[model samples]
Target: MSFDEMDVESIWMDGEFVEWDEAQIHVLTHGLHYGTGVFEGIRCYDTAKGPAIFRWDEHIERLYDSAKPYDMEIPYDKEELTEATLELIRREGLESCYIRPIAYYGYGMLGLNPSDCDEEVAIAAWPWGAYLGEDALENGVDVAISSWRKYASSQIPTNAKTTGTYINSVLASLEAESNGYVEAIVLNKEGNVAEGPGENLFIVRDGELYTPGLAESILDGITRQSVIEIAEDLGYTVHDDATISRGELYTADELFFTGTAAEVTPIRSVDDNQIGSGTKGPITDQIQTKFFEIVEEQPEEYEHWFMPVEQ
Candidate 1:
């Protein structure tokens, strides 16, 4: 869904707020031409205390981490980026919205080498409902095993959320949508289950939970880390590293996806095979419930994960 002009009027560009429609880069921007950039999708929730950003420091750290490989130096320090993001959210008066922090190479030299290009950063926040669909949160979504294989870390830094690498994701996701499924479950170069387009995959069987590790060409998602912790806290053994075959998904007791956008979305079916009971399973509900509690209510125990922003 596109944001209305009224929904997001102000955008933080480099250290100043500008009209949302005015935040633009030259057509020859290096990142636009060659896709040399890094970005982070963070969520701010309307918790009881106020509008708090989830894993604020972690996202900022990852933002820097994402830029490191490209040799892109974000001019501003982490503190500046963090403050800019918070101020942008406050300025927009958005209580619950998706926050995007992107650092890209700006126009300078049109040559293939972006080493001499300038690193530009911007932050924007606006209300975005469930990424898949509103019903997808509870009823779950059907996804196809994309013909597109995730690039190996050796080919590119799959661990980093580089913008260029997402072309592979785009192809996979487009294939799924064109084929009528809600999303795509992409496999890695080695034919092992990697993850969804923008989310990590978790499989449940025998009451134990499992997800592919960084070795599987999957991102080190903060939400994935939270789900592992929440599941373990509930006395469930969660394996951070697991080699999941495409066939394993069809027979799993329950399957779900985790990420900043998807949150805790259950996967009801893959290739039309009903996963478990074909609805959100017991363990999935338990984990999702606890995860939501932390984000929405700002539970006292998990307060450290949230950074409160003055509304």
Candidate 2:
């Protein structure tokens, strides 16, 4: 059967497995209205051993953590959602797919307050190859420094993965595309580089690695943390501090972005200035290669991050 013909089941409204086509939510749902929800992006990789969920525990933990700032309680516990996500992927027989878990305030009487609405959880899986398409990493992406600044912690918790906060990212991304750029780097209110619209930013300079510090008003991404750990383990010196000025990014030896969806993608240019001869640098390529190997190779040390699913 073709991929489209394959039966896919999803966990709907309160954890009911229904045909994917039948999964529905009201238009007036609180989350839809005021964006009162939080979500996660997880990847399941098809390996020689079987299909394994990558960083399964980390993703689930972040899902709950993201909800805390919004005061949105996930109706299910960690293990509950964990097992359900695995089951959803298996039901679809997806060897390699992306899993999305969302917890949001369901339909309720119209008002801005979300505490009155019941929380709804849903899990959906689909075949996802690359988030930004194939050529994004191969040739490196052209990035623009967005006019939209990252939301300050005073406005909303900068750490949580809230749907509401993504409006800024959405706007930045759309603007970048319309301006002939593949992605955007959003700065903080103080005009310091924070991160990519949905990814963490890293720069290499003088044989040292640098990324915006935690207080830089960027989401502390799981993939960003993993990349840093992997780099340190490989004997690289990392400097986490403020990254300001376009001059810094333009003159860096290499520039790259890290996140669940973006993975480790190299940036070829920032606006019109060429970064390191306008090509994917050596360090960026090394980290990307190592990341792929670990995600697919099942190294003993990283085995705990994978949840095996086999028929």
Candidate 3:
């Protein structure tokens, strides 16, 4: 569909809504040249109350956090951005959508350094569904252990979702897709299972949940954290530890990936070995069901995380 004709799509450029084709940046933009931008991928769910931004506050907090290491200062305040996001969703009359807020180094004198540019912000929204394969939720996905290794904290902070960092994910994802795998599992510099290219990794063993710890160059995924809390509430003990070997993956009774776009997806196999009888395991399915329920209504503890848009 044409940009304007596409229902429930809005592009917020600079400080206002613009035609999708009109949202352009100069070639000299520092972020374009040097990958010096930081952005957040957020989801808005249609609920009984109209539309609710899932974990809106947490996503904005991470957007700001992602900017700090690059010394980039965002121009807008939290409440302002939040309001803009809500308005954009409402204007589009969207039921469910994907929202993006980006802070980047704008047009500037060209070269390696970025000091000559100003930081610019843009927000956009579009109707979005599952980010992965159609059967990814039910049949689960097959993943290859990528030859590409994840970046070390000493080289670049993995904690921040910087544009520069995603090159690693891009290459790994390309490699995985080319090889007929749905995603790639990148290992840390030390050969530990770091995470899926775009999501955090979780495995279930004997009915308990296990995921890579924060120190292992993970993104500290909001969905991962939410799943942990939900798992505990459901009486499942969770483990956060370094997943050092492929042996753990092959032996695990269940596996999954978690992120903003990923939501909760079970991993049916790794490389060629089947994960627990080659089907979505019971605990993984349980957590996935609970997650869907939780996002549909704000649990008392997570109430502050959501922002409601009027119908």
Task: State the weakest 10-residue window (summed lDDT) of model 1.
Answer: 1-10
TM-score winner between candidates 1 and 3: 1
Q: Global CA lDDT of candidate 1, please? A: 0.91
Regions more than 4 Å wrong, model 2: 1-9
lDDT of 3 by residue, 1-311 (tens): 33466675457776788777678899879998789999999998886555789988888999999999888889888978887888888887887888889999899777766778889999988876787865898779999999999998888988898998899999999999999999999999988889999999998988888899888888989898889888998999998765657789989999999988989999999998999979889999999988887677656676666778772
Which ranges of candidate 3 are over 4 A from the true structure?
Answer: 1-5, 299-302
Kindly indicate the candidate among 1 and 3 with the higher lDDT: 1
Best by lDDT: 1
**Per-candidate TM vs. native?**
0.98, 0.95, 0.95
Number of the top TM-score candidate: 1
TM-score of 1: 0.98
lDDT of each: 0.91, 0.85, 0.86
Indicate the TM-score of model 2. 0.95
lDDT rank, highest first? 1, 3, 2
Clash pairs detected, candidate 3: none
lDDT of 2 by residue, 1-311 (tens): 34466556555447778877678889989999888889888888887678998888888888888898778889999878877877787777789887888999998766898888999999888877777767877768999999999888778988888888899999999999999999999989888899998899999988778999888898888888888888887789888665666669878889999988888899999987889978789988888888888888878877777889763
